[model samples]
Target chain A: MIQKEYEKNEKTVTVSVVNFNPVWGDKAANLQKIKTMVISASQEGSNIIAFPELALSGYECGDEARRDHKPCSMHEEAAETIPGSSTAEVAKLTKELGVYVLFGIPERDEKNPKVRYISVAVIGPEGILGSYRKIHLAPPPTFTEEACFKPGNDLPVFETKYGRIGVQICADFWVYPELSRILCLKGARLIINCAACMVGQTGPEFIAQITGCRGTENFIYAASASLAGKERTLSYYGRSTIAGRAFPSFKQIFAQGGDREEIVSATLSLEKGQPPFDQLSLEKERIRSFELCANELKKLAESR
Target chain B: MIQKEYEKNEKTVTVSVVNFNPVWGDKAANLQKIKTMVISASQEGSNIIAFPELALSGYECGDEARRDHKPCSMHEEAAETIPGSSTAEVAKLTKELGVYVLFGIPERDEKNPKVRYISVAVIGPEGILGSYRKIHLAPPPTFTEEACFKPGNDLPVFETKYGRIGVQICADFWVYPELSRILCLKGARLIINCAACMVGQTGPEFIAQITGCRGTENFIYAASASLAGKERTLSYYGRSTIAGRAFPSFKQIFAQGGDREEIVSATLSLEKGQPPFDQLSLEKERIRSFELCANELKKLAESR
Candidate 1:
């Protein structure tokens, strides 16, 4: 496959994304299709390339996913190891194209003996940067994705050539605010959210507000890659989007087409902007106020 | 006192406010001071006249704030019932001026075997509409005023001659989002914060943003009554302000007077503006995106 060579390097932050309309359960064909898209991303000069969650073998595995499920989750069987063929494919392209990539996969946990994790692989210039698992599992309405995937406990922030990087799997951004807070505090100028949201749920507006509020509250940049388009069993909404604090530097989006997938690109500036000190100070006032209110009423005794 | 004869037949939202510079220990002078302010608020056509916290006796009561130490905390100390003395004073004015008045005092909570509450009284045209205790307290380093006050827990949102009315003490606005959220959710279109904030202690920018964000998030108006001039023992910063999504109200105020304990007023239209909801939505987006990095980031994201 002919990979795209990055076109610009003028201190510009660029985004490369691939939108795959894969045939579910066919890992072999999906990999072949992804190879062409990954190459195109490299040729187009994407500094950071991202793919949808569970893109390796497609999103709906059902019983197959169950069989592959680790002791606790379907995600256990999602991916084999860091050096698995999927990693090799992306690593080869990343090394050759000289760019960063964020992809989703299922894997077994090395610790705790039997738990498997649904994590996003963040491959950087040096090697696999790290992985962030879904913290807030989408229980009820979404039907047992958590039954197969073990939840991630620690929040990890990494230093990369671009900036301090923070990553999280799908649904993590929706329920928990602490993860976002931790990332911002760690100086993650940019946080990437790789999600697989189904059709007919709280659409783009809900996603935008959730991500936007978190970014505004913490003063950090947030980018997201969502699954798009539909194939049997699952319909991925194709509007994959990127967001953050810097302009003309971090926006890139993608859509899907027939039989295979397509890659999209954009530019992002990773420079630091407003520090979060002011906002943090602002929140401290609330806590102080809480104490004051309680104390005065106590002195008032029965007043409380 | 020629109390303002406000028209209940008319649809007007009048906000009553009291400006106080506490002596921290003086009650007699503070009481007299509120008497004059309440009379003035009533005479001047304020439908809802309010006062700073503990205006009846200065907020700095320390250990002497308890009912056992002071008769003011006892209703049998019998200032007035609904038409008691303080209530009588406000009622006479509201009835004379045809307006409503809300003022703060040390309330003897008669319900729970003699609890004293630092409360604000809402005196309507007919009688005492209701009372709200300082639910949130101000504790130490919180300055000279922290050690004595007890916090109130139940937040009561009342419906008056105007739209819906939600009354809260000073620091209450800073901590919980639930109070304002409930008010708006309950159809209270306007939120009035009765407070006494210190200079340099409270960041104006943060307050404005919080107010604006709250308004936009809940779709309503926000008004705050902060002490205008420094009273004995306190340096009052008089920049009481009003904010809402229904108007194009923008003002550039760098430094305001540290003196002048007068009622500074503004007319806020609860009526809808000419702009469509979508236009307003976009306008809101633009204003929120004012921070250069966020705006640029949003632009880039959308452009891509």
Candidate 2:
């Protein structure tokens, strides 16, 4: 794993985004790859490290015809519980390294064996914090997330020693701006997106643009870790990025990985003057719009 | 005026975005400039033409100190009614040329002369169409819109011969994604943003990025026209753009303008196969999320 760092100062938090390809349906190999990266990142002094969406089980789960013909699909077989074996192993590593880790996995419902969710598991030193299921599933015609997985209902923000962090899956971050806004209102200083962004879906540049806007609009740090390389018919382009307010004013890409396998890191100062956490003034200013937006939203809902 | 056009077919609508510096608070000169551009654009076969926000009186309304000291500030003095002399003249031009025009001006409230709005007036061949008032006012610390103008409460979609069009001012377009989504839900085929986007507020590239996202997310044509050159302490970068889905799939920038004074035009195919008007399938797909988004928004509002 290659390591790079931004200039660090007092009251700073360093984040690392891992961009790698997972062997399709190979949980053991993927878990080992993730552990190695976690250890390396922890040794490099990263407070938080994030892996791409569906990194544990890979993205594709066989063709539609085959899945329909078979009694149990590859995704169903690979799906595990939130605090299942994979997360338990990662939690132990996080506990030993004293660093937080976030990665996506197929989550099997505890009550119903048939139900599954495309979720990102947040593992901290204390153990598994929680998982944020994919809220906005990729729609039909081109993408097929909605066919296999059920959409998530809640938007949860996890508390960490470094700061409050909110997680979003690929479509949740790319398609819906409301999710990020709600997360920001709930006091999330950082928004992390775990994505299995494919080349055919949208341009890599457009993804970075949306990621940067999420940060600029909320005045918070936004990071996206995406899967790379080809698997089955899909080709994932891993242009992972961490975007937020740079020193004085303008929002920019703090650190970015390439379209190939790589790890990008950036050290951000959370002090008052150093932005993405200018909470007091900016939030007060934005509060005026919240009521207006909420009222409009309510009206739209009532009409619908 | 430099004119450039994308290849047009049988069912296509051409749009022109004007990037020009208004003579600060000079109604006569600004109106004359607008008329000249409209006539030029109409001759170039543009079905619709849009100008920057506060194009009549310019963006800055003196300074905070001057505004506090004077009984009638420059903005108040310059404010006019929706169907006032400016729109009347523009309507005459549009009627003569057979085209639709959208441009910003200081709108004086019918009942209270002291109350003003940063609004975009829509004028067509028939006469004066209604104006859309700036909903989300730019807050303090930097912007002075809230201090001088009353926020508009409604989101109106105007029906035109070409399509249904929605208008948004600078802060409304940049800050709130909800407004655009609501407009899209209300059956707006195109969203036009009139902005006096200053350099210090955000990068020009960032503005284009957000503009593209607005189009890509909603699956509709999104266009932005902004003021060019300097006005007192503020330096406005034009960079107006028209973004939407290209031929088969990808969302891309169809047309764009530069930092200096210029006029950009694009001929967009609005046919069934051609996108930004793929209305049937895309709209049906997005309806599922609308109810969910609306419900979440209501919850947020109630909590607030």
Candidate 3:
């Protein structure tokens, strides 16, 4: 694994994600907002671009989603299946402009009749790749996700000309280490978290650090895009972030545009992965010896 | 756990540990030194006190331990069993004096016949309650722990009037989630780590922070004592530190004196435990949730 250190700089992929605070019941306004973002990301040379959860329908579709979580409702007639209308339009742009795209949409699960809510990522490389549904719904008492959404079971990691990738919808990243760790074990070094990060939080720094901490722990690169701006039922914090283990600290590449919402981009490298363990880098292996010592103590305690 | 809420002040336990920079062949000098420190901890009102690993024999016995890893040889005749001579000596002052003591010793495993280096804690309700051995060993190429030690296996927690306590020998804490988490799970609130943390050939602040970082991860109180003074082999930074999950930041209650040696003490309240995870006061929960949201992005990178 210790390949002779290369003299050249590590090659990186520049990816952009939009953190647009979508307006509830305002499909045209949100579409215009997303269009501007997609255009900016394209101009910025982002090979691939993504948006927050429910970016197309907006996160505040609370009761509206319960009525009929369909894209065709409320003027979003263009929002259809992964390969239906939305992908068709975005795919046409991909061929025209030669840029990859993944975004959020009101997903209808073909497998289960009862499951329906916000599904994300209209994957496309040349045309359309596939879809990823939001898993681990935040039920009532926490949020109303369980009532409106079916928890996605399949965790898919994407591989394009760019890099190995994994995608997840909001709140799926909480304590379910298996979701992302499985992707890492599957050799997917890049995991994208599509989040509608809520507004009015505390310790932006610590919240931001989790990306880097997990990256260091699991040995991978992770990027998260969150919804930015205030909607009706919820206000989205557009402070999206990305982290790689190589860096000492996680960098916040995207800040919710103070006023004008914009796309944020950063280059993630694959070469500088660090072994999370092997913490014993010094001359004195205290933790190792302590283990022996603790074992002795445990035996004594049990006997007593 | 919410009992700490109504209290006017927080109860903190400061377990003082003595660090030894042992002379390669000088066990008598080291034992005499420990005798003095034990007497001082009781005088200073330290509710509990500890010593570094293999404090009596000095950590640099090397091949001499191959012959006999005892405290005394020939004229001196030192090494003793768990409740043997040294334990009796240590308990004499502690039993009546109202201080709990944990010190390192060379344990003779009667069962295996193979003499392994043991880190034992001779705790006293007012004296020696029991003992613990060093479970995890620090072997070669990794560090210098393999020079004269064998590993121990087992995890144990001790119960006393002070609290249900768990003991970890230096390196053991790093490997055994079962050691730390299980202790916490099984109701051991206080975790005492005894190590003769030698001042290796590295910067002191860097090592201190590394130790602090480990303490922060496993949410429990940690009182570590390292050998102090320039005892020939290595320099003991003498900065004996004590900390817990609540106080992630390492606080040195006592440090080694410049030329001579001294004992430091702090009164710790066994009652001042953190609030239960479920009833995590509003302000605390907000920080936790905010951190949860931020770390959510990192979720997909690493797996359990």
For candidate 2, the per-residue lDDT at B111 reads: 93
Candidate 2 — which residues are off by over 4 angstroms? A1-10, A65-72, A273-304, B1-10, B64-72, B247-249, B274-304
Enumerate clash totals for all models, in the order shown. 53, 0, 42
lDDT of 1 by residue, B1-304 (tens): 0012213324455554444565444555655666677677656656666666666655444333342343232222322223346666657766777666666666655554345566777777777777777765544333433334445666566756665677766655543443554444344666766666655554433334434434444455666566656554456555555554552222111112224576644444544332323222322222222222233333433644
lDDT of 2 at B261: 82
Give the alpha-carbon lDDT of every model: 0.53, 0.78, 0.55
- What's the TM-score of every candidate structure? 0.49, 0.90, 0.57
Model 2 iRMS (Å) reads: 3.9
lDDT tens readout by residue for model 2, A1-304: 0001111323678999988799888899999999999999988989899998889988875677234532237688889999899999999999999889999999998899788999999999888999999877654445556667887878888978766789999877876776677677667778999998778667777667777878876677899998988876788879889997664445788888888888888998765454323322544444445555556556655776
lDDT of 3 by residue, B117-139 (tens): 56675667566677777766654
- Please give the ranking of all candidate structures by lDDT, highest first, separated by commas: 2, 3, 1
Consecutive 10-residue window with the lowest summed lDDT within model 3 chain A: A1-10
| lDDT by residue for model 1 (A1-304), tens | 0001112223456775555576665666766666667677777777777777767656654654335432332334455565566777777777877778887776556654356566777776677776777655544223445556666666777766666768866555543443454455445666777777666543433344444434444455566666667754777654555544332211112222222245655576544333322323433443343334334333433432
Q: Which stretches of candidate 3 lie over 4 Å from their true place?
A: A1-10, A15-19, A25-32, A47-50, A60-84, A87-106, A117-135, A168-171, A196-202, A236-238, A247-264, A272-304, B1-304
